[model samples]
Target: MVATEVGDKRVDYIPGNSSIRLVDFPLKDASFRSRRLLQLALATIPWAEKSQYLLFPSIYELEPQAIDVLRQELSIPIYTIGPTIPYLSHNQVVSTNHDYINWLDNQPLGSVLYVSQGSFLSVSSEQIDEIANGLRESGVRFLWVMRGESSNWKNICGDKGFVLPWCDQLKVLMHSAIGGFWSHCGWNSTREGLFCGVPFLTFPIMMDQPLNSKYIVEDWKVGWRVEKEVKETVLIRRDEIARLVRRFMDLDDYEVKEMRKRARELQQVCQSSIASGGSSENNMEEFLGHILHGAKP
Candidate 1:
């Protein structure tokens, strides 16, 4: 199923133009309850085909092969104007001093790990406990963004880390004190991590997350997987998590140094794509030109 082609291989979609793995496809396994939502999401494909234009919130440089292939296969005009994150907000000054920012500022450069599992579809309490305990044991300085009951976070994280309900995710990732990211591999988080040039510790949950993790760990070689296999039944213990976190945070590690290097390279690519006359900029201009000039369908 992983190697099975879904359509013509005339265009290079996946790396080497290989067939998308069954596991890599979004919503690979849909339960009866989720089937309706899955159908609704899938319905967009045909709808896009009938439209005059299609806009992707992604950078052409990031997925050149996929974007190029889609333009070749599809009849309508397609534009990649992305990294559409709240980058503009970064310049604005906050009225109040955030404790998290102060904490990050005090930490040594690239000495902290930033952890967030995403706002939706969180892991089980058991998994959460394991992760929290593991970070405590790892002896690494970390900033974990978690929602809900925070009463026991101090005990769980010990003195090595800070836990909060939320923070400016992109801002946190871009901080000089942040060394690495422990992420759920959501596309938005993944993009932010790449943009900030931070290596990842992928703990993907579902849907596009697993595929994003694959790209981070395998294709990009900028990160490592926290879970060898993503299964609810498989609980990664505290000791293992501690060990992985330790190795990941070790900046002196030769492998880690290389991974960080690759991450920076990708970050440069992301930056260039958004700069003047960049791929993303050009695409945005073209898209607006079409609209302003009232180009025919």
Candidate 2:
């Protein structure tokens, strides 16, 4: 249900599939931003109406409260599917014996961490250096992607890590050597870890990252957040960073194994869903089945 809180509006087009993405909304804030977004969505609603499918990755997105408001107040037909990353991995990423891939191959299983912030977020030189220093001091083998910040972090313990400008993220995570992910907990990355059976060393940045982190650290029991800062001045002590990284890497009990098993099961289910007769497959089919089922366009 959309929040009656916002005066009918649409705000943003969330990324991921057109189908799933509701659990990520910070609803109270979006209500305030809805008016102009309402204008934006209205300008496109006519075009959207002509289209056969109604997909909103995050229903809570773009004043979905308003969309629910409008849908309930009027009668609009919009259908939703779920956490779409699992269903979207038909694309294969091959990581062969490139020097980087080869380097990654040499690390011990459950011994290396994969750290990145996707392409959209950038860390300051200090933060990058701090992390690099931490990883180096931890004596960990890592495949870190620090794109567009060559000068920011190149000098800090360069050889102990493979600091690529970017790498095939999916391929890196799927590697057996990757024990955990040091991530921003973006939905795609969070879901990627879930899919690959790699746990997380979460350093959530903004928006849904914090919420996704909660599921990882608290609900799932598979990950932990690195640090909490009031505004921006948080020192990254090399020892503490190493300690948490070790915690995520440490698979001491049946607990880690159980979580890994669950992740694998979900991965299988997710893979199955995108195939014929699976939930995502069926969901897509049913949506297509109704194209001319006498509903008003």
**Ten residues in a row with the worst lDDT in model 2?**
15-24
- Over all chains combined, what TM-score does candidate 1 have? 0.89
Worst 10 residues of 1 by lDDT: 1-10
lDDT of 1 by residue, 1-297 (tens): 222243112223554333344555655545663466567778877888789889888888777777888988888888887877766333342322789888887899899999999998688899999999999999999999988876568777998799998898888887888999999999999999998899999988767787788778877889999986534355899999999999999989999999999999998888888889988889888889888999874
> What's the lDDT of the predicted structure labeled candidate 1?
0.82
Winning model by TM-score: 1
Quote each prediction's TM-score: 0.89, 0.68
lDDT, candidate 2, 1-297, per-residue tens = 234333123334633213222322333224434445545746896886466556643313313454565456444466544436632332332236466667766778767789998776555667777788888777767778888754456567566677778777777787777877899888888767776777778776545675677667755566766863323245667778877665556678565566556666655654565566665566566777676475543
